[model samples]
Target: MTKKIENHPIEDVFGDEICEGDTYFVFGNETVLQSNLKQYLIEKQQVQCYEAI
Candidate 1:
């Protein structure tokens, strides 16, 4: 399953009422986060992405 947030501006992706400083918790194996170059997203957006086991 996949969801795409396309055709949206940066503000819409992370600003209030959207991401709103929320943490995107990944409920999967370590490889799940690593597979999609997701780490780069941290540096890219300056937000936190936590993974749960």
Candidate 2:
């Protein structure tokens, strides 16, 4: 899971903010891609998440 840095706005390709930890997850095979990362940020920690189109 990623954390947001204050005042250092995070944005998508179109310049729209991607809430939650300002992050998104896709099907990958990397060690850092934990299955619960997205869910944890939203459900467990209750962060405002957005999906990138």
Best by lDDT: 2
Best by TM-score: 2
Instruction: Looking at model 1, report the run of 10 residues with the lowest lDDT sum.
Output: 8-17
lDDT of 1 by residue, 17-36 (tens): 33333223233422122333
Cα lDDT of model 2 by residue, 1-53, tens digit: 56545554344323355454544443342211244466555754589997799
Rate residue 11 of model 2 by lDDT. Answer: 47
Candidates in order: C-alpha RMSD to true structure:
12.2, 12.2
How many clashes in each candidate?
0, 1
Candidate 2 lDDT at 21 equals 50
TM-score of each: 0.25, 0.32
